[model samples]
Target: MPYTVTIGREREMAEVRALLERRGDRLISLVGPGGIGKSRLAIEIAHASADLFPDGRYFLPLEGVFEPGLLLPTIAYVLGIRDNGEAALEERIARALAGRRVLLVLDNFEQIVEAAPLLVRLFDVAPEATFLVTSRTVLRIRGERVYEVDALPVPDEAARGGERAMRSAAVALFVDRAQAVKPGFALTDENAAAVADICRALDGMPLAIELAAAKMRVLTPQAIAQRLEQSLPLLTAAARDVPERHRTMRAAIEWSVSLLPDEQRALLEDLGVFARQFSLEAVEALGAGRAWDGQALDGIAALVDGSLVKQTEIGGRPVLSLLAVVREYALGRLREHGEAGRMRAAHAGHYSALVARVAPGLRGAGQGDAVVELGMELPNLRAAVRHLVHIGRLDDAGDFAWRLLVYWWIAGFFGEVRVWMLELLGKDQPITPHTRAVAWFFALWSELWQRPTEEVVAGLGECVRLFGESGDRDAAAMATAARATARLQLPLPDLATAERELAEAVEELHELGNAWAEAITEVSRGRLAWLHGRTDDAQARFDRATEVAEASGDLFTLSVAGNHQARLQLVRGEVDAAEAGCVRTLLVSIRLHFEEGIAYGLEGLCAVAAARGDGERAGMLAAAADAIRQRVGVFDAEAFTVHTPQLDAMREAAPAAVAAGERRGAELTVAEAIAIALPDEERDRIAPALAQW
Candidate 1:
């Protein structure tokens, strides 16, 4: 599309023109608040100058370009320049622009402020290139000329004939946006006043105006204008953009809100509380759709296209977000309708009930299904936790904290999740012991992760108390495993926690004599010893666990033993032994029809292979692991996080390193990797970030 206007500020455009004419090619910074038309103006200038710059203009969007080091590579990508490992960025820039006068439009440059120096250096070398950068704030580089864009032109409503009669910034924006949506949509006598008011009410901000205009495709201009007026922050600051009578952005927002149907309005408000983008399934939770899902399904699509929500692509699903300003408008609508508190309460209840149902269910045969379900509800669960804690529903809060642990571990959310769990364990929670056991396990895990002395002691203490008193033997065994895990996280002197639990579970296992449970308990015990720097003890327990699992035909337990045993062996610097254990686990998992187990086993085996300095072998194993993972259902970000990208990065960087070492007759050892960066250290960092996704 050819850019229009470089528009709005006549004086700024003149200044820009003067600078470009004099300097040949200079860096121009177009800075403004979001929705104020910085991007529009940059595009306009780029289009107008295309002929001046004989080389075609290039637009580089920097949304995902966070790191400064990646800037050149990203630019190279846009320019179709091959970026070899050692390519000099400035030389590439100079060569690319040598005989060409090219206008480069850079969008969202503020996110990479640290990279501005490099960009400036590029500009210095590439005199034939003119840079137009659009950002939320000005990039104050030396010799960079800045143009600050104000709102669009505004005119007096009474003097104007219709929408045409009003030459205001607010009206211009309304006309611009509405025409695009409802082709040739203009303010007539019927809606001219309404259009002016709507534009004026949304602060004549281009983004807000565009949003309101989209609404008019369904709503009359009047209804949108009126609905927007209800919210004060959205009420436009009485400026000269339009008539003073039509001023105030809050009015604009209120007008827009008034246009939506009752259910749509409700959905919008409940969704406003979300910080990041969410999905339709999340919005569906707002209505009483538990049994009546059709209504929610019916309303979501209409609401999305009306500009009330913004849809963003997220993996397989389309996630939605409200513009920041629009969200403020929706929040106001929430309070006005007195539905925010009620919806929050509902959210808390839904999540609390869900966790309670699934937490205990996880200790039994339906674990795989439970894992899948938990993954889907993670966002809702997080929302529920926030609602419960923030709204003072402590019982619900406790339920959320407790039930989320196993999911947390299985999903690999070991870092901040633990800290968050501790915060949820507030004073005198009225939740059941099973709930407390769940909370205790997470708290203990978090304590170990954060390396706190007192927290470790307290977390283990509670685990013992809960495990001893829990009436159900299966639940108690799960608690025993958790308590032992807590001990393993602490120093070696605390082996009593794992040892006592192992002994208790062993006795209980014989008394009840459940082979599958016995296998799980034995593997957990082995895990405890493994983490405590007791290699022999860990190996013996894993061997026993594997034997018990195989004897009972419990493939889950067998896989767990295999992966855990391999991990322990790797930590002990026994690469070949670890690989062997992982391979056995992989074989058993495949035979048992458990795809997830197979994925876990292969991932561990690949890590072992990498640790052993077998680059080609490790790559093959990792690829096999990834292929299996894609075929198996991914439960949650937590499950996804266990496949550490750091391991992947190491694998990538190690190919040549491994090949060279091998050629020199030096074999890589697991101990060498251990000395570099512990496997746990990498897993701990990557897991939580993955879960958040």
Candidate 2:
């Protein structure tokens, strides 16, 4: 759990600590080429500055977080901030860190530079908190201090056996790791020259040196140095145009990987399909087991021994990952073998299975766990969907995309998913009627916010027809409920017709024993009653819907009903209970990664805050909800009509305060919005980051 054994970073560590401690550099990013030990150096600095940051010192790995939207939540997750559906996560984190001194380390931030603004805002809001980051490049945020981490110092070619030769930082590191495998392995009179040559040849990169030294258990230093001399340049020729250090690192990876047997080499290359960490079972399920002839364990062991793979534990489960440079190298090699397409297909198939396996739990008590799992696998899933779409594999792509509808909606990934769904639908490839129905459903769901009522209604009609024709009675019933809800939002709402339609849908859902569907219909009915001034009837409907949703373990429906129930409570002047209900639903929505739920909850909280005469807080909640609605392309026109008059009156009373609140809310991420909505009495439910560690 302590720092990895680093030999030559003492000076770098001291300088980094000074930058963070003495100089008051709120954002200090360690920038360097891949495999140059930037992450290791950052870790070392965090350990050294442990005492300076009295509040907390936490490390958040961003390698698993590929989407910019996830940045705030990922940070909150590491900080142990639980979202209460009422407050935004950004506000929660900022509130938690206000006037507090803490050290937050974000690693592998290169791919998520779009989130730099979020980091900057955090710096502004939490002035006392310091941020340490490790990336291949610097974040160009103002006031950022870039620390360049370079390779270690290597011994000269003519250096002979002595303390002086061993004193070179690179030589020292190589010797240290070499001794781990070959006990007592030292730069003796016989091999000191070859050891020095090996370090210099590896360009003093710690990773390359460690990998080369791993081979010392079998080969002599002279032979290892000879192999590097022969293979590095030839293998790295394609990358000659890259930076010299980068080229050197890639060459080292190429040389190390080349030493594996044919099967191990093949497996290593194919493993490049994974975006981040992966499990052994995923590897086998992805077809690597068949590729390796069931020798996956042996193949993985060989890669681990060769230092081509790094093994770590996540959630008590072992995960294998390749260093960034190594993965890139393997991907290039895999492409050269003309196996890219096949490997991608296999990757897509495996993730499809993963989605299918977890889909059953998305609406159950395991919804939270399901969301977490899907979040972990999101990057790969995105890649799979993209690949299938690009290759015109419409059936597989449509199926995969449709299966993630709940996930996409819950996680606020509707915008990205909408693009893919539209692209797939526009393609000329033929798809099954079932797939078509699912696609149409997603198309309507995603475009509902931005599209016109007529267009959306037509899409809904087609979706209903397709579901009906596919012999999926429950699905058809669900679609019917959706159509009825949309109709209620029309300018001249048809209360009688919509109510009848919802009733029929509910009956069908009940007959099918589909609690989730029936719960959705009940909420629609409740909304209709509430709109018609039937408060008691609406409350009863909401209660029944919540009961059914709970029994079915359907967080989506539960949260939806809770949203309406909170609105009804607000109307009845139960301010505290309304706020409590809003917070409860927000937490469930946040847990489910459902953006629509979070947005709706925030709106409810906004209305409650307005009813309480807290105009500023109300404005902030409304703005937060608007931001989420814009991001996810979803909006409830009726809800807006209901709340707007009151919020506008509150906003007019304190234009400046309300505007400030709105600005802050607009800056908030979904997690932060949820946190801000949380009442003080509910803070205990937010998990502490320490619990995760």
Candidate 3:
């Protein structure tokens, strides 16, 4: 259709084809961002489906026509319906194609989107005709089925090898374009990674890939990729054959932005502060003091309609995002208007307050929902923290990081927070002692399992002093409990000291009415009791921990205590009770999206399977647990030692089956592994949430 073959759009083509086959979908709109190959895909679909329309397949190129009134006349001209002063143009066109099963392909309708209603009217008059439209925006008329044309799939890091990289649609397109520009150019082992990098950096947009590949006439793929940091300037094409707007990625985006109303355009520029997806609440907060404060929602809808912003749901709440290229363009507009600094400060302030407000909820009854909310906003949260730190607001950054301590720990974001805290602690500027103490605690806790237990205990001892001196007795007691937990992990653990400190910490937490911290302290005590071979005492402590966690509605602590009880159940040879306990804990962990808790639940299930002589199932669950542990950067030597003996016996009995199951499990995602570990009924109950994840 465009002198080049289409690449990597088979799924889209099939989906659009299916829609077209449906009689109700008379008006099908292929909508996406500029350079996403919408026009090309529409032409290919129309050409391929020529047989479906018995009359004819007509193509009308509307890129040059910008006026709304010219649209009807243009369609009339394309259909060869000359205006002869007899009837109206629409009537004549409808009469000419009334009974004909024709297909009309309208290209570039975004500039004249106001005329969209005319297409519906035309469709009403000519019942047998189907209109296939390619636009940067949706038409929003009746009977219009929008098919979003996404960018081609690019190779991820794992698939960046020679032949593996070529499997990507984006890479294949780039190779085809490169060979056209420079004959015999192939994807070799040496240059494959560079090509993959270029494709990914360009976000897999077709026009951008073609433009970059055209540079193969002189520059290497590596050189082109290196220059892509300033991609807006580097992605221009010098070919006179290409349209002026299509010659550069920037011009293509500008053409779309030029068609927007002033309010929507301004809102888009202001929204450049978000580094990732943002919620409507976030949009409202960021717009609070701006001139368009009350019009943000309407403006966002308009931007979404105009294809400048992408809208999706996370946790059943709508979230908006911009493509990397579009965001870059919006950010450039923001800088040109000199509002980048002000907007970025507002964004950071909003997210900082957001995390602070949700921090308490993460520790109590709202733990599950709060964790999901924070997880949904994590990218924005990270961006906010980085911006705060960048603008010399170390105190605010550290405070925000500390407030989200529970969320960070649950979502496996502690490593990232550890880096931010390290940067904050390294700064020469002064911060509040409370912030300093929390920052040190985060830095130490993130590496508690990776680093030596002695070092963690020593660092946490300082945190305890800082929190106490800063008048935060709750934090001080929490740190005291953490120090004791670390001591219990040491080679020759000071059991007596750990027992004394835990007892003191629990009493302090209880007096302070901090049930969440008290629950955690009890779990530590339960672990201590179990180590001492005091089965009755251990069961009592775990039961108390569970009771406190349930009272406080702390899912994290509940999962912890539940897993501990499950381990005791297995020790007592109560297989059924142990399995039930592990499944219950897994449901709680999945609800909270707590990777560590999920891994522990899997480990408990693995032990149950081993006890039942299901070697394959045990090995599968164990490998899955290990995968989560590796991803979360957590290792529990004590727990590993407890399970090691049974796991070894299972492996020894059925080595091949265990090895095969381990390989299969290692390849599963967290969600897939959860499916394997859960019973069908429980999985069905959690399907909706897991699907969102």
TM-score per model over all chains: 0.55, 0.73, 0.62
- Cα lDDT tens digits, model 2, 1-693, are 321478888788878877776846889999888889988888777777768987768888787466676687666656644432112556656765765578888989997988888999888878889998988877898889889998998888667875668889998888887887789877788888888999999889988998898898789999998988888878678676887788888888778876778889889988888876788887877654445868888889878877788888766778788877788788888889898888888888888889999977876677778888987776688778877876778788887876666666566555455556667888867887777877777657634543338667677878889889989887888888888877776676778988998999999999998786788789889989988999999999999999998997889888988988887887688888888888888877766666667778898888888887888898898999876664443443445434576688788887887788898897776666666788655644664421231
CA lDDT of every candidate = 0.60, 0.78, 0.79
Off-target runs (Cα >4 Å) in candidate 1 are 1-203, 218-249, 273-286, 289-294, 356-377, 425-441, 449-455, 466-476, 486-497, 506-520, 527-540, 543-560, 567-693
Off by over 4 Å in 3: 1-247, 251-262, 313-316, 572-577, 612-641, 650-693
lDDT of 3 by residue, 1-693 (tens): 344678878898888888878767899999887778887898888888977886789988665454566677567545644322112456767766767788999987887999998888888788999999988788899888888788889899888678999999999999998887689999999999999988877778786687577667767999877767454443455324444444455644554465467877888888888965788788888877676788988998767655567777754677787755577678888999888888889999998888878899988998887886776676688778878877888888877887776776555455456657777888788888888888888877745554437878998999999899989899999999989988888788889999999999999999999898899899999999988999889988988998999998999999989989888888888889989989999999888766677888898888888888888888898888876664343443346434556778899999988888898887777799889999999999999868866
Tens digits of per-residue lDDT for model 1 on 420-474?
A: 4556566455656755765666555544533536566666657657755766565
**Deviation (Å) of 49 in candidate 1:** 22
Using TM-score as the measure, name the better of candidate 1 and candidate 3.
3
Report the error of model 1 at residue 198, Å. 7.1
Error of 3 at 37 (Å): 8.5
Query: Where is model 2 poorest over a 10-residue stretch in terms of lDDT?
Result: 80-89
Q: Number of clashes in every candidate structure?
A: 35, 26, 0
Q: After superposition, how far is residue 469 of candidate 3 from its true place, in Å?
A: 1.9
Best by TM-score: 2
Each prediction's Cα RMSD? 12.9, 7.2, 22.2
Which candidate do you rate higher for lDDT, 1 or 3?
3
